[model samples]
Target: MLDLTKLAQQMQGMSQQLTLEATATRQRLELAEKLLSHAFSRQNKLTTHQQTWHDRLSFTAAEPVEPLNLRIAIPVPPAAHTVIATDGSQIAPSHHEIAYCYLINVGRIILHYGQNRLPLLDSLPEVFYRPEDLYISRQWGIRTEEWMGFRRTVSEAVVLGELGERIKDEGGGMRDEKRQNRETRNQRVEAVASFHPSSPIPHPPPHPSSPIPHPSLAMVDGSLIHWFLEPLPGEARDRILPPVLAAWDQLRTNRIPLVGYVSASRSGEMVNFLRLQACPYDTPDCMTHCSNQGDRSPCQVLDPLKDAALWATQLEPGQRSPLWRSSARILDLYGDHRIYFCYVHVGTEVARIEFPAWVAEDADLLDAALSLTLAQVQKGYGYPVALAEAHNQAVVRGGDRARFFALLEQQMIRAGLRNVGTSYKEARKRGSIA
Candidate 1:
């Protein structure tokens, strides 16, 4: 149990330390803001040096796709559009349990606006109890919890892709109906023109398909980078990344905007890029120049701040920063679906919004995606409604975990399994001890 009195006593010193850090952070933020203005003054030189030195840097740095200082107001989304989001929760395998097993529950939410359609919210749960499922590889000594977390991520992506496919199918049906109606009208016009050859069929009105009915978006609740796969062996990575890439491919091929929303992110990719700009060397190198300096280095002036700190001042509510190509090594395996990101100030906080390269390249799709994201945030009151709904469906409470184990024990007894029992610690905790 936590001792409140001791914690209370320690809070005094903690408060003092935090106050000191806050004062230091203010000075650093001022320096960073000035440094950013200085770097942008010679944008051409910064870009040239970054292009040349990006690969050599030891830290991850964002590659600018647009002017570094560019910030755009959020566009209005179409009246009728769909936003689908997926999230996942998992139960890790426990040694204290009667059975070595885990569960993954993926939540899916689809919200339609301006059409007055009811939203769709549901979850899909799968249980893994086999030995192969419990262990990734005995040789690699991979833990179940780590592997299971990645597995849950995969589940989230696959479910999001499935929802994307569903939306496409629904849209396709609508398109087919429109096509049939057009064909039927053309035939009637031909028939009427045949009876009166002098009258012409009004030239068929050029490109008759009214604008491609608002855009649809697919969203997942976290980073699309799959950073977890970075440390795994080639075989393990191979087993994990293919499905995720396939899911991204599905959205790209269908022209569906896909995004990963991260709220109040502490990432420093863009801040590291600023560090590159602050480097004194003509050709930037982290190991050779700044290796021994640690916090004393010139480039370390902004080390205390995250990317969000830098943008919070630059971006107003409903505005977003310019796109930057992520430097994650896992993205090299992403093919044409390489992840790109921008920071958006969504009233509540600065959020890191990541999407595939295809979405970033297209002007219309980019606007539509961000607009719909902003719309979702407004509707949900600071968070994306679809993602928020999905979280509600995905969350598993503490009581649910207890009941899960209880159900497993009962099922085992019904199946006549022998030597099935909880750990002594688990039993003692459950038993009365006063």
Candidate 2:
């Protein structure tokens, strides 16, 4: 048991140390900001420096697509648009459980603004017990829990793609029906019209009943960088990557803007770039030029800073920083779906917003991504409402896991399999004195 008296005494000392650290952090932040401003002042030179030392850099830095210091105020989102978000949760396979299996539940949310209709909220849960489902290549040494998480990510993307496709098809059918109806009406009017040969016959006015197509934005709960695949062998990574890429392709084909929203992100990609700017050496080669300097390196002044913390000081609420293309090695395999990201201040904290190359390249779609995100944040009071709801739908509680195992054991006994058992540790933890 933790000793309350000792803990309280330690906490007092810890608080004093934290106060000193906070002061130092503020001074360091000021220096980092000045470096950022200096880099912005010489944007062209910095760009050339990065390009020149691209391979020799000690850290992965994002490639700026626009001026690094550019900040855009959030524009008004479409009065009527749909936002679809997905989140997932999983019960990893455990050795202590009565059954060696896992479960994945993906929650989906669709909210339409200005439609005056009820939102759609639901979840898909699937259980996996088959040997093939529980394992990848034994030689690859991927843990079951790790594989389960990867599977959950793929499942979320697939569900998002499915939702985007359904909405696109519905929109298409509506347009087709409207076109056919207008053509039929015009044909009937032309057949019955009686007028002078030289005079023009009036056709029915353009149909006002057709609903205007509202833009759609798709959001997922995390990064689309696929950085986790970098360390895996090509064959192993290929097994997990194709499905995600195909799902992204589906969304692109449907012309839906897809974004991955990371709340209070601690990513240091931009901070690393600022460090690159602070490099004193002409070549900026860390190994050859700065290896001997150790803690005295100029770039170390910006140590321990995150991209969000840096941008939080620069962006106002409802504003977004300039876009940057991620330089992660895994993105090379992403092809047309290269991931691009920017930072947005969501009123409560800085958020990293990421989407595909296509979304960033298109003006209207990009606007939808930015504006709808801010709108969602405002509606949810600092986070996207759809994403928050999707998480609620996907969460798996302790009681649910307990019931799942109980049901599993009960079913096994009914099937004439009486050997269902849990590890001694698990039984003891459950307060069962078997």
Candidate 3:
């Protein structure tokens, strides 16, 4: 009797397992049938001329407007949380190397002397003005029209965060590590080194044998360098030293800002400036030529000090001057009562596009711009076609086949793909047989 009871239990367990397996199989089969029906229906609806037209269009009709390249500058105070979002494909075809940046809670954005905005202002505030608002106001004689484009760019920045968050929330197989690495890179750590100095400072030399550092660092004015490298007392220095060192290490491996010249011809002037600064490193080969004219031409050298001079000139603040604007202007903008600044690079070789001010103030407008931009890119590159294909495949293979079929039917009706007299119920009924 005990053996008989054990056998019966085993049989019951097997029966349950078999039932589940059969149910899963049935669902998969139904899904396949539904997908076939949907495809067939679509094919039937499209006349031969429509199919030919679609084939000929080839998704290249929606080319994006050529990107416009402009320098953008935003004044970030010490320790402010600044978020910068960049989309490479939005402005042009992505070439694998795209830059993104984020700045965190710092001081007020200096619109003009004595005007500023509070740190951490929301993207959209219901009340345009408040007594304690720290944002730079146009009423203070700051130019608003010039900065309007920057605001639109920042609103789009939110899209980067959204894309990141979506990837984090949705876990898939194999690509998890890649997504994590991207998130890690996007996170902005607090900067330990300060760029502002309170007192007169001493000059620090570069390590004796490092390659000429990027020209941008070389061009940092003496005053700015002193401020950036301002000394902290023993205890404070010890506390921040580790992070500063880490940042320095990261900068070495990553693309630190290189000095940009107003013109390729002025490179020699920059080289001379670096020599005066007494930097020990070599000049970049790309910036200057060998001075030795005889049979023995001196090995062309990079002048680090000159590079720094060029960098400083590039970073200088002036609207009309050739040397004053760097690429930073593409990131800052002006708006009603406040100035919005971003420092992310968003552009392509063809054109570097910046945002308009109105879009930045309105979330809906920002979304619309992104959607439109994405659609344009998709039309040009066939990205949307790939996405549509993948989505169709997933719907066809997903569990709950009946529900999937019902949804497809509803879509068809909404799309006006079928006659009003024929309900989804009728189409679905006919679909199963066909």
Candidate 4:
């Protein structure tokens, strides 16, 4: 017989813990609300964050306008353009399985739109299986990290590069079959034009003026800078550099602008900027002098309000902030490909968009890149449809994961390796007690 008094005591303890957690959460929220109010009130007064914080911060960001205006909007995308988006999905090495293997599945989309309202979508998916593919060098000692995800992301960019190459080819696959048959090419083009304004793609004897090529934009699903691409201690940069460099080379050679689109980012670059603004002029450097951690930092009054929080109300749909340079550790190695970023309003949310400094320097390419991205936002109703579609193609659903394991087991049986077995824990999870 259990003691009723003990049970009551335990329940009371649980309730007390819950109450404490709730109080702490509320305190955090109140601090956030306070900072947000201050930011909004001082938006106009807090200009020049870049000048003060540029050297101290690992990354830099700026509002497009000094006074924090809310009515700004970017122009509509050019009449026609191409957008290629790539996303990665993976299955980690499962302890439940016999083999120490993992898989990386990549989804790629090629979208061309403009004269036609509907986008023509072409998708490709690839799977990788190799020892090198499954594991990174042991010096960093992180076997559990998803190295394959990074590899797939690099490969995804390669996909865009290849497509761009094909399109740029004088007589490549992008060249329409009908156009090759010179006798009836004109007639076919007219027929396609009459029947389907959008269908007549991949061929044009030549566009009248400067043809806006199909690969004007290549979009990545996440931040381009990641640990895998960065220099690790004791690991030779030579081994890790070629693929990423080649991928960037491919995009550049084809004159395709690449963007690393980050949705719902909580990056603190803007917060650091705000902190720098709050620094007392008397202090040479506040970060060192005022090294208080957490809510105790002198700038903690501005705690928890990220760039997204500050600009969510300020940026109108399709509007974007001025570009910022990233001084992140990995970017230090990027050489001529230093990344620049801006916050763009996609209607549903404010997102961080990053591109190479090259795009920022080239006015024409920058405009084209922005227009292409904004059009995607409109087409997808606040989110880029190409990114959405690529994610759909790349995502590894639970059912598919189970099916893949089943297929692997079946293949093992066929190869006379039926003796292979899974952990009892895995079997129990499958159906053991249920």
Using TM-score as the measure, the top candidate is 1
Which model scores highest in lDDT?
A: 2
Work out the TM-score per prediction: 0.89, 0.88, 0.17, 0.74
lDDT by residue (tens digit), candidate 3, 9-37: 79998999989876765554444334323
Question: Model 4, 241-286: lDDT tens per residue?
Answer: 5567677776676677888888888786655555544556543254
Residue 428, candidate 3: how far off, in angstroms?
Answer: 57
lDDT of 1 by residue, 145-237 (tens): 888887888888888877766656545544564666655645543442242223443333222123335588888877778787888898888
Query: Which stretches of candidate 1 lie above 4 Å from their native place?
Result: 175-212
Ranking by lDDT: 2, 1, 4, 3
Candidate 2, TM-score vs. the true structure? Answer: 0.88
**lDDT (tens digit, per residue) of candidate 2 on 1-434:** 58998789889899999999888878878988998888888777777777788677777888788997789998899788888889999998999888899999999888878844346688889999999888764558888888888889889999998877655544453456467775464544343233222343233322322322778889998788877888888887888899998998888877788999998787888888787778877777888887788888888887777888888899998899999888887898999999999999888999999999999999878998899988998999888999999999998999988888888899999999977989989889879555
The parts of candidate 3 lying over 4 Å away from their true place are: 1-136, 172-434
* Global lDDT of each candidate: 0.81, 0.82, 0.26, 0.64
Q: Worst ten-residue run, lDDT, model 4?
A: 166-175
lDDT-best of 2 and 3: 2
